[model samples]
Target: MNTEEKGLGSWTEREREELLELGHALFACPELGFQEVKSARILEDFFEKNGISFEKGLSVTGIKASIGKKGGYHIALVADMDALEVRDGENAYPFHSCGHSIQTAVMACVLKRLKERGIAEKTGGQVSFIAAPAEEFIDFETRAKLKEEGKIRYFSGKQDMISKGVFDDVDCVISMHINGDSGGPLFDINSTLAGFMVKKVIFRGKASHSGAAPHLGRNALHGASLAMDGIAYLKDQLPPEAGLKLHPVLTSCGGTVNVIPEQAVLETYIRANTLEYLLEAGEKFDRCVTHCGEALGIETEIINTTGYMPFAQSQEITEVVHRQMLELCREDQIVKNVVSGASGDIGDLGYLIPAVQFGFSGAEGRIHSAVFSVGDEENAYFRTARVAEKTVEAILSDPSLQVKNPDFQKKKEFYLREWLGENRE
Candidate 1:
């Protein structure tokens, strides 16, 4: 894995080996959201070995390390530190199917290079490396419990971090994700991500004997079916450019065949390309569910939880990244202006600060699947890190590349008031 063979002369052989090893270590011991103890330790040990100091215990397992002066133009290099749950046969285990391990490794490499070369000091600015947890947005039961214990207020790591004042002083953010090889480009820039909200509806009805007195009982499952039908019909009215998505699953319907079920539970996420459409679609969805339940003589209870916001990448920062990508690869190997239906917590961060999460290809299988694996170490780890390092340098050195700074308090107040509602507080 020499620099001459891969054209990654910026990194020494020892540094390259260390970065790859770090990625492998994180990949080997995968952990779920908000429970990433081992993953956090791996990153902490790496920072310590590199003589970089960091603060831990954020959102339970998140770590924040910074360099250079404070109260200046600050930029963040964000990495998500969690894995997806993959089921094999009857068993399920945590796996790095989304290439988050690669993200953490690349950000760590960038931070190390910046510190070793004193780039931040020379530019008279600050750069923060944030190893954020719980980007997967799973394990709701655990998160609910954590909320009850006052350990966390938001389910997503970045959301909780924002609430805890982690991004208060940050001016902009730079993040990356690993994409499966499409036989097209090695890098993707200026991609748009969907915002989403979680909905849990419970339909309540009367129970009765199925064979003897079926007519006397109200059918909750029937009510849920009608609501689903209404949603399906409403889908036609939604705008295509909104990129809305609704996938509902019945978590509980009935117990036995002979008994009329007294309750039915349906949960899903409402996703859209922007916050305006997201809220509008959510109101329509709630009306559909409630009206369907009313028509069926069943009582419906809806609980809404705030999910990640939609991501509109900062063109300012994205242009810098694009230039960096071109320096490493041909124009054909770089993709721009991609719109994806995927959702991530980085969207929440982007609401307050200008953020860009570019995608890189070096994996062999579909992300979030059991078969996903690292196919090329050079493209995945070395080249990705080089681009990030160069982008940070460019942004820090050029003061004119600054992003608009929104009032943190006002933005957060609106986010909590409109999206999270009064119940979260």
Candidate 2:
């Protein structure tokens, strides 16, 4: 790709430097989910300096800045603003192992460039830059406390935004993530993602002295262990195409070693490729856990929470983006139609309107691991932003480009009622 042909010739050196500086600033202080105080402030300051007015505190820390008028074909460019907790030796700290800092920075750069070039004025359609919070599902304890205080109703940030009518005016969504696996290609388009449901189980039994009267007590820990074994055995029966993944962790199993465990808590996620298959696998999983605890003469209680819907990329939008990718990368350097088991809240937003999350290669090391770092800042931060900006311009310039827009309210109600069992008025 030559300089002019690369489509990056228009990007000024100052803009390029600003992109790297913003990425590095975000990477320096990685904050989790809704607690991204410093991270949010940095992006907010950037928006202020650029003269972009934004609404903050949507999902506690999520931000939205809109350009152009609201009535036309509205589009949103989403950037997740949360990081994972990585452990080093004996201590654990928040880090951008998932490269969300790159997403935030690139989107910020795209928004700034679009505003500077007055692209939105040409299209007469709105372009919104959304800094979404709590894409990562970890830190449940803190989230639960927030829930008790009525700060948030859903664990995922996108769900909360949906319930709060954040995307009510938005027509579609375009987002990107940094692909840690650089072996694939520079860009990946139209990849599918799995959806998952959060599961929590509790087993209760009578406590007794282990040394004196072990036989009189029903061990809850034994029940949990048996339930995990049952789940492991059921895995073989599940179809491979379903992509069933169940990995339960024992969060609590008694307090002392001398007494028989009277309570055990297990938490996991049931993930699958489609909604029907996800529910089917969830039913089987529940039965396995419930029966296993019953067999051990322990009382079992299970709680279910909606995680995310399966992500099916919009083919029409993807084709448009593919043309943009071909200009910056070789034909062979773009991967298409790959399926992945990883889940993201973007899937939830896809249920209401057309959404596509393209992947760009620039990072190395395993994602969600401590060693993950950006190896190619040019591709991760600069090139990816160019493709995103170009895609937006293409979509906005061609009013003929269209995708199926589902009934926003009906779908939102169905998601909240059928999937989440909540009937919000």
Candidate 3:
């Protein structure tokens, strides 16, 4: 590896190449959340090849790999193993448009380096290579099935794992995601992400033959149209800093021109920065659906399956990573940044630990669209590994820095109570 002596550690040339190759493979095979079979197996193979042990079969597609054992202050590192559901020509329905595959590859590379250099032995603690599933919140039906079967109670991969007590032994959680553009200063930390809830609304009515007796049909399409109209009008009355977002996609629109529609399915995500904003905005959206359903004389059912809370980064952990990026990744590599109101499962972890989510961009394409591409050879991967290594060293070197979570007691207790299906009030 090209050594940049910034008082931080470096990676070997072999290490860099291995990381690059991992990125290439992972970027190519974009697996959706919860169904990241290939992605999970590939990472599992890498860990097995490296002689790291883990508690596999945790959440169908999630793997809890660990390094180091016995008594010490343990820290958890997460690499979300799922990709978004986007048809990018090569891979239909699932693709790496979000660049999480690269993020996972780099995380694996970091874990490997930590083991090869015996950093864990010196630190006297543990590190987890948690390949979490269903980070995208795309497959709701399957998640609902998993919950029904007692396989998982929570729909989100991270939330489910947490509900299963996966991080009980962990102190701090650290994870990074690939972002957009290069050379821009990466976000050192987030105050919190915008929180959101996933809602699936199904409008049901009586269908009739369009050409034969169209007037006899109870039009579910009219109800769906009204619901959409409400959403279009709702965009203006949202809070400024709260950052409300409403993305409703028409998943199904009843029937063909020959038939009068009986069912229309609409899936939407309601969001805001604070829980108060989230609840308030969600209420308005809820009212729109109910009122629209009433107006069209169609029964509408809403299902809220997933919720991603906001995350607040620990100044303690970020200062070290931010410093490493600044010194190691060229003179002006690291810059100040804030939360972009994106929703994620890491927020669930942040409620318990002082976590930081940071990374570099993989591709230059527009993020969620079909052209979302992972610029395979971006310097972000190697630089990210180096930063992680540097951060690990910093954590291991300092005794007063501490590895304990800031909100462990309160959050864990609350979640534990929730898991038991008890009232938390």
All candidates: CA RMSD (Å): 2.2, 2.7, 4.6
The reply for model 1, stretches above 4 Å from the true place, is: 1-9, 209-216, 255-260, 422-425
Model 2 lDDT tens row, 1-425? 66656456589878888999999999999999999989999999999999998999988999999899879888899999999999989999999999999999999889889988889999897899999999998899999998889999888888888888898888888999886566568998888899999899999988999999999999999999999899899888778987888899999897598999999999998888888888888899889989999998999999888889999888888988898888787989988788898899999888788998999987888889999988877788877898889988998999877554868788888888887667732
Q: Pick the candidate with the highest lDDT.
A: 1
Model with the higher lDDT, candidate 1 or 3: 1
Local accuracy of candidate 1 as per-residue lDDT tens digits, 1-425: 55644748578888888898999999998999899999999888988888988999899999999888987789899999999999889989999999999999889889989999999899998999999999998988998999999998888899889888888888999999986574658899889999999999999999999999999999999999999998888778778998989888889997589989899999999999998999899999999999999998999999888888999988899999999888778988888887889899999888888899999988888888899999878888987898899999998898999776667678888877787673455
Q: What is the C-alpha lDDT of each candidate?
A: 0.89, 0.88, 0.75
The TM-score leader among the candidates is 1
Task: Kindly list the per-residue Cα lDDT of model 3 for residues 1-425, writing each as its tens digit.
Answer: 43564222456668777887888888788776667888777888889999998777788888887787756767677878777777656876777777777778877888888888888888886777788887886777877777788777677788878878788787777788766665455434444577778789999977998888978888888898899999889888885777888889989985888888999999988888776677688788888997898897899998765478766677788888777777655545444456567778887788777788875654677776778765535355766777776787678667776657666777678755642233532
The predicted structure with the larger TM-score, 1 or 2, is: 1
User: What is residue 371's positional error in candidate 2, in angstroms?
Assistant: 2.7
Clashes of each: 0, 0, 5
Clashes of 1: 0
Show pairs that collide, candidate 3.
Answer: 1-12, 1-13, 34-134, 362-375, 363-375
Superior candidate under lDDT, 1 versus 2? 1
Q: Alpha carbon lDDT of residue 140, candidate 3?
A: 71
